[model samples]
Target: MHEWADFSVEEAGGRTTVVVTGPLLVSTIAYLDDDLRDLEGPVQFVDISAASPIDTVGAWVIYRFAAEHNAEVLGASEQAEVLLEAVEESASTADVAPRRGWFWQRVPAEVGAMVFELGRSMRRNLGFMGAIIAALLMLFRHPGRFRVRALVRQMELVGVTSLPIIGLMSFLVGIVIAQQGAIQLREFGAEIYTINLTGRISLRELGILMTAIMVAGRSGSAFAAQIGTMQLTEEIDAMRTIGVAPVEALVIPRVLAAMLMMPLLGFYAAVTAIIGGAVISQVQLGIPFLTFLSRIQEVVPVTDLWVGLVKAPVFGLIIALSGCYQGMQVRGNAEEVGLRTTRAVVQAIFMVIVLDAFFAVFFTEIGWG
Candidate 1:
């Protein structure tokens, strides 16, 4: 018998019996552990009829002792038997090994998975582009299918309403450029050349690029979220069910609006930036407005304006397509909508920059530099 528990061993008819008593709980687990460890010799059976309120910890201790001794349990109540069975099942589960590949072997597996994912993404985007193109062709064939009212509304939403913020951003960018150019040119005794710097940079690069980026962040994300929400609510599915093409109805208006308005926005941005540059030149470089205008006329050619203008519709198309594609890709829930919206903006901006770089290289090689 142990001091902490009513445990004893008895022999009857050459069979050894171990009796357990008292509460088998967390508080007495340590005592149970010590008693269990002291138990030696072959035990045929363990009696737990006297044990009260057995728990998982005590069940585990008693079960392990019986397993090691090849002993069967005797006189256990229903609660004790349930706990012991649970412990036995848990022990069996714990014996299984966790799966983990070696580091060198995992590298190729991870790389292959990434490649497969990339391939799938490319195929999906290509299919989406084909669908959009087909929808546009169908609309062209059936001119009456065009939704003029929706297009106008989207134009107002994507273009006109975006003017103030885009104008302000471009204006501030122009001022900063003029100020920086003045400082740099003044060091070389050529402060008047700030007009040339601001005009060339704003018309050739900054104006349309910044406008595209802004639209991607603003209207592109809105398109994604709107379409994604519609998809989540099954409105998109309903449209298809009612013999309405979702791409023609939902995507075309936004795409056309972006394409039609982006060039206007870019032109507005360029003009606003030039005005801001002229203001800065007047204040900081002591150049009059007419002189600044004349300098821009002389230094910045018409081709520079054309370069920025040409990029506008392409950027708009990229933004709209990316937005609508990601929106269509949305599945399952609200969280997916938010995630895809963010991805749309990011992808649109990235593609815009990449296309801009290509244009820059092409134009420079063709003597537009």
Candidate 2:
């Protein structure tokens, strides 16, 4: 027989009663916690008197149940109190907050909650930065354990596997850019300049941006999923409990691998996109291959390539950082792995675009293309 069943909380007259029947297990305690989250109002008192055979798990269940619902434990048994004490200690260590409601509050709680969350995010980032520094220091001490073969695998997966998709995407992008430029330039009888426009814009900006976005979705999410799974399985914790540092074991290799590969991928993407543009110019504008290539050379310079190449590492760093950070933060089970994976992709993509914009503005001012 499993522990805990038909768990319900109800109010009668002046007392609140939490009823549970059966032998509660760890899973049941987690379920009870969900039930506790649903409660409302200012509780005058709580009656856990009907609960039976309240062992350690049962005691944590009852304590969390009451604490989350703002209920006071009334007429508790000595065993129950002991159980509550242990649970409370754990909860305190976890930084769990008891439910508290304002009495006829003037300000809306949601607005305050938003500010609170923002502050919490800032704090989390600070903590993560400290952890990162510590991880880096640990990695510096022991450099040999990081597997070059695993890094090569990561590089292939993140960089090489993304080629076909990026090729097709950039090809379509080149077509669209050329079509749009041809339309406008043809009106001005400047159709020949379409080669110049496509090559310049693509090599300098769109190539890097598109490649970064693609990698964030593919490689970034994979990093998070891999590390998060390791975390969920306690492999990360096991590493730390031994002499190995979790960050050294997991993070540095991924970061370095991504940094090394993303630029190569970006270069491949740029070349393919230029090739894509050449195909369109060859077919649509009746321009010869040599003529299109000459025009691209005339307009796009070495600085254009340099600008895009330099941004690749930044984008790679952003993706790797977000992925490894989210991965390390994962808790519980597979659900957390999925959640952190989504978060890594989303945050990495957003940061990539933002950084792309920064690069764009800087390159424009510097006359890179």
Q: Write the per-residue lDDT of candidate 1 for residues 1-369, one digit (tens) a residue.
A: 333455789899999999998888877768668878987788999999988878888888889989989999998999999999998887864436767789998999999999999999999989988988999999989999999999999999999999999999999999999999888888889887788889999998999999999999999999999999999999999999999999999999999999999999998999889989999889977889888888898999999999998999999999999999999999999999999999999999999999999999999999898
- Model 2 is weakest, by summed lDDT over 10 consecutive residues, at 19-28
Instruction: Count clashing residue pairs per candidate.
Output: 0, 2
Query: TM-score of every model?
Result: 0.75, 0.69
Clashes of 1: 0
Candidate 2 per-residue lDDT, tens place, 276-319, comes to 78888888889987788887888788898899899999999999
In candidate 1, position 289 carries an lDDT of 81
Assess the local accuracy of residue 182 in candidate 2 as a C-alpha lDDT between 0 and 100: 90
Q: Which lDDT values do the candidates have, in the order given?
A: 0.92, 0.80
Which pairs of residues collide in candidate 1? Answer: none
State each model's C-alpha RMSD to the native: 6.7, 9.2
lDDT value for model 1? 0.92
